[model samples]
Target chain A: MRAHAQLIFWAVLVAALALLPPVVGVLHEPFYVELVRRVMIFAIAAASLNLILGYGGLVSFGHAAYLGIGGYAVGILSFYGMNSGWLQWPVAIGASALVALAIGAVSIRASGMYFIMITLAFTQMLYYLGISIEEFGGDDGMRIKTRSQFSGLIDLADPVASYYLVLVLMFGTIYLVHRIARSRFGMVLRAAKSNEARSRAIGFSPYSYRLCAFTIAGALCGLAGALLANHTAYITPDFMHWTRSGEIMFMVILGGVASSAGPLLGALVLLVFETLLAGWTEHWQVILGPLLVLSVIFFRTGLAGIIPGAGDE
Target chain B: MPPLTLVFEQLLNGVQFGVMLFLMAAGLTLVFGIMNFVNLAHGSFYMIGAYLTLAAVQWSGNYIAGVVLGLAGTLLVGMLVEVVALRTLYARDHLDHVLATFGLILFFNELVAIIWGRTLLDFPRPEWLRGHVEIFAGSRYPFYRAVVILVGLAVGAGLWYVVTRTRLGMLIRAGASNRTMIAALGVNVRLLYTVVFGFGCALAGLAGLMAGPIYAVLPGMGEMILIQVFVVIVIGGLGSIRGAFVGALLVGIVDTLGRAFLRPLLATMISPTAADSAGPALASMLIYLLMALVLAVRPEGLFPSRGR
Candidate 1:
């Protein structure tokens, strides 16, 4: 009965999201359209993170680097007079994948906290690099003067068109992630996460599997980055800031990190909370900080865990 | 501007920076080594110490009295936090420790901002340590910096003695090597952890007080230095004081030298304009690049402690 309800709950959520823009339009609340766009962009990033953090059990504290790399890929390419989404998006994904491969190759050699710190160090290095490039606006960052041209099939300048594009991409990502999570490869990844020694005993090398997962997640996040750049029509080094990475991690933990749907839930809740609290007062962090502490202490399974009749499994 | 004099002065600067890093890294290594805990909020003590010193100096009209009170205050705060918040996280995973402590960081940052405004706090050096010393061929070094180096070294030596030459040191070592055996031997493990934590907090506080005059004391100041300190510990080897000391000096020297000379060196290879833009950027990245290199070559660090 609970499983049936869980399925129904998810289906209703997707239907509601698909109908959000029209409903908001009827209510004359275009602001919510923009808000939901931000949520979906982060949802893609958070879902990618869950692949490594939740299932693979790699606590990559620097996952936001992909966001920056993806953004920069679009920003830099457009600056160099390439605005076609076909070329720009692939390069963004490719660049992030390459960097991920490099970071993962070195970082996977170490285990536990060491891995976390190394990943952080690498991301900080990238953040510094982003600020150092004078042509790319240096510390101030650059504005994307024009959105990536989608070859006239879809006009990115139109808010409605861009909104639908993000929505479709988010659904595609959710489907792809769900399939990956339940596949044979995901089983091996989870096995390694739970018992590396035993997995190695069973003749599976954890390194290649982990490195593969890390790269794929980075690629997925890079796609999200491309969409984010288009949505905001601006990219900054701040996208890869350490705190941004922390926020992404918090989203994964908040949503429950159990399934693909959890990150989407987390992203929406976080943005809504931020929006509501910021409206109330500027000193929202003072409250949010303690709330995070309380959650970590009490909500081990996170927001998804609170669902009625949801078993431990 | 003479090359030799410049090199000598930069070396002194590097040593001074390294000594300061040693102060922060020592406490960090101790906590990690003995308790098997990753305390991200260790920097909070540093920030609090600086703030307390600033307040006490303004109130008491005596620098020495202010420094003493500042250290004591931070020590107490550190202990109180350990008892109140961190005690529950002792057996939790590092992720839990990270989240809880990160939350503490945000809380402390906002609280400080609310109390003391977001502006920088200026701390003037005492008159005795104000002038410069002509130590090299017509090159003058600040007396305040010289004193900072001396104090850091003195504290480093003191920590070495306490860790290696005392009974408490033995228990600490034993605890790091085998917590179960020490607990079974009826050692007051709980008291020891608290004491060790307090001592580490004092060390961080001392570093903060010393840094107050050299750098602006502001909210989140601890975080600025915390990353470099982590690099020191990683390069030196976590859980090893000697490694931290060596790593700190190496980092300090390399960082100073890179900032001073990397641009010019790059200029020789590339155009001056290209070098100018790339110099500061590369200089900023030098330490992280060094850390990556070290990890690639020696994953366990240069001085892994016994059994870890």
Candidate 2:
């Protein structure tokens, strides 16, 4: 597909998501709103990860650390009686960015197996830290008493409104990532990923660019974490489990990696597949596991690769 | 100050923990270093090892026999996995290895859960191995745990001898540094890979079975200890057995000692309430902080393999 076609595909996706709530309402299937809302939140996370994993070539197996940080930022603040989105959400993003900065700065010094192991080890560190803290529900986690308040700007308590809010944010996240992929900075990031020594030789130090990209991805994922806390009305250290990070990376890969439409499609397909399988049987993962193996073996290009504008669109 | 006996006892406990971690990490890092293949499903071998031991024990009604059968079963499973799923993956990138093995983890976890029932099972030790032994003036440690340490050290020594003195170890060393040269010299790289992977599985199996008698055999139990083993491998340097041994001991002792002493130490330096909370939190994160500092200072690790 041409660039224009790709743009249209994204535009159509957002438009359809924008209009999904009313259709569900007419069909008396209000449950679909929550389902899609959950998908959007995950989609945001997957897309952010793609920025680093796909575009930046930093295989951060610890992305869930941001999710936990973002979530706990909300959960802890709420525990202290701050329900304002303005205060809660920004802190979530900022905290995750800072943590990401610290983690990335240390891990990025090494590449390949060292990098993967370091990222994973660091996340486990946070997981243990989360479990040790006694306040704000510790391992059992705590409930969010209320949704983020906007002072009469828009009521998030309404499912439709919450759905729309997630939809807007998801769409914006995907678009922002797409823009980043095409920019000079994104080029440097991609260049560094493909050939770091070459990029460095050509007067571009890939370190700062990679770190910047990593931080941006972390900050974006933090927002998704905050949204998730609101959506679930609960927060737990389990959010940062390596398995969750794997699932997000799976979505990025399952969708066309490093593409605009890949994560949205991938998240939708995976969640829906999981939902249907879950409804069918309790041991659905038994089937899902082999299917993932087959996909990795066969779907070399991912679901997005099957479409036009497959490579880095 | 903490009691001398208590500290001495904890030190022994830490060494025992390190011994078990060494068994698991040595093989994992060996395979990782030699084949350049990342096998995240190594934990599955551990799980399968525990489960198989349980099944074989119930069927044979003999503890030693069950352990032998369990190790054999785990080794066979490892060989099969390498030949069937992992052989083709050698040509692919690391990401593919990771993802495919991850899928295998899901499959194996579910498979174990399905076959064995999704509940914890008790692994009974032999009659003589059930009691405690006095190792010091005022303390006695669990006999089985002490056995675990002894058995672990003996195997470690055996492994060291084989890898350093034996012809097979030479080939392994040769294979790690230069696969193409070995393959060109008529060595079957494929067979070597399977052998190495099977060895890893057997070692992991041993760790699992020994651990079963100590902790209840349960699904997903391997994952909990696997990360710590990973920390051992990273700190010890990837694919280095000596590194694994040193790394495991360092992590186990540091972790055990930190959890034991951090609270009292923190109380002396800070407020009691702050120490109470911060101590455990920092103790848990200590290994990771150590890892980060290590990686930051030496990316190739403390014992980087010679000649790449």
Best by TM-score: 2
lDDT of 1 by residue, B87-174 (tens): 7888988788878888888888888888887899899887778999999568999999999999999999988898889999999999
Docking class of 1: medium
**TM-scores, each model vs. reference:** 0.96, 0.97
Q: DockQ of each candidate's interface versus the true one?
A: 0.66, 0.75
Candidate 1 local lDDT, residue B94:
79
lDDT of 2 by residue, B109-202 (tens): 8888888878888788989799989986679888998999999999999999989999999999999999999999999999999999999999
Can you write out model 1's per-residue Cα lDDT over A102-171, one digit (the tens) per residue? 9998888887777777787788788888888888998888999988987888888887778888888888
TM-score of chain B of 2: 0.95
Model 1 accuracy (lDDT, Cα) = 0.87
Q: Report how far residue A162 has shifted in candidate 1, in Å.
A: 2.2
Best candidate per DockQ, number? 2
